[model samples]
Target: MMQTALQVLDREYLEARCSLVELGAAFDRVDRASDHEENAGEFNDSRLELLKQALGILTEESHLPNRAERLLLLFSDLD
Candidate 1:
């Protein structure tokens, strides 16, 4: 039997909230540290681009169930 949305939320909400807060804090730290650099170019990095893309995937609202797979492919080297 599958759990309802509220049941899942009740069990996972705190952890999920903490993870998002952690991610936000990490970005804040990066921004703060980059502020003192003359040529930070924080947004120009490929890794940052990948992270933005992953965030895009996370923010999209759709019925597709392959978000995890999409994120994995986004980070994978297909060569």
Candidate 2:
């Protein structure tokens, strides 16, 4: 269910959201082994996958669609 949503992001957006992209990169490094990191939960593939889902919602918004909910989703969980 979650992984499929991440893949859906590849279809909806061109450029990645800046903060989300950076957060993802940071998380990826931690995933690769770094331990001292912020947003540690983001490092898990499952969580990272969810962030992708959230980012897609933000970036694919048409002419800045309402993002208040999506922004909260970013700080919260995808499920």
Candidate 3:
């Protein structure tokens, strides 16, 4: 169940990325028309940063169990 949830989250991450292009274009329009490039750029930058953080968390959560198992095996010889 947790794995399935992680897979869903991964899919969401991909979908979010696909939508970013269109959203960025809209931001560009605002940047051009209003001559507020910094505002638009900052908004897009913050969005991208948030997306990266979320994706990183999802990836780490998905792999954590496998990593733990591997660690256990790596130290098994010491027992």
Name the candidate that leads on TM-score: 1
User: TM-scores of all models?
Assistant: 0.83, 0.39, 0.33
Error of 2 at 61 (Å): 2.6
List residue ranges in candidate 2 displaced over 4 A: 1-21, 34-45, 73-79
Q: Write the per-residue lDDT of candidate 3 for residues 1-79, one digit (tens) a residue.
A: 2568778788788787877776678656755755665554444456555445544543465634575454445445564
Which lDDT tens digits does candidate 1 get at residues 6-59? 999999999989988998898787787787688774535688778878999988
- Per-residue accuracy of model 2 over 1-79 as CA lDDT, tens digit each: 4668668788655554665578878766766663556665444567666766776776674665568666686777457
Q: State how far residue 21 of model 1 sits from its true place (Å).
A: 0.9
On the 0 to 100 scale, the lDDT of residue 71 in model 1 is: 95
User: lDDT of each model, Cα atoms only?
Assistant: 0.86, 0.65, 0.58
In model 1, pairs of residues that clash are: none
Task: State the weakest 10-residue window (summed lDDT) of model 1.
Answer: 36-45
Error of 1 at 15 (Å): 1.1
Angstrom error of the Cα, residue 60, model 3: value is: 20
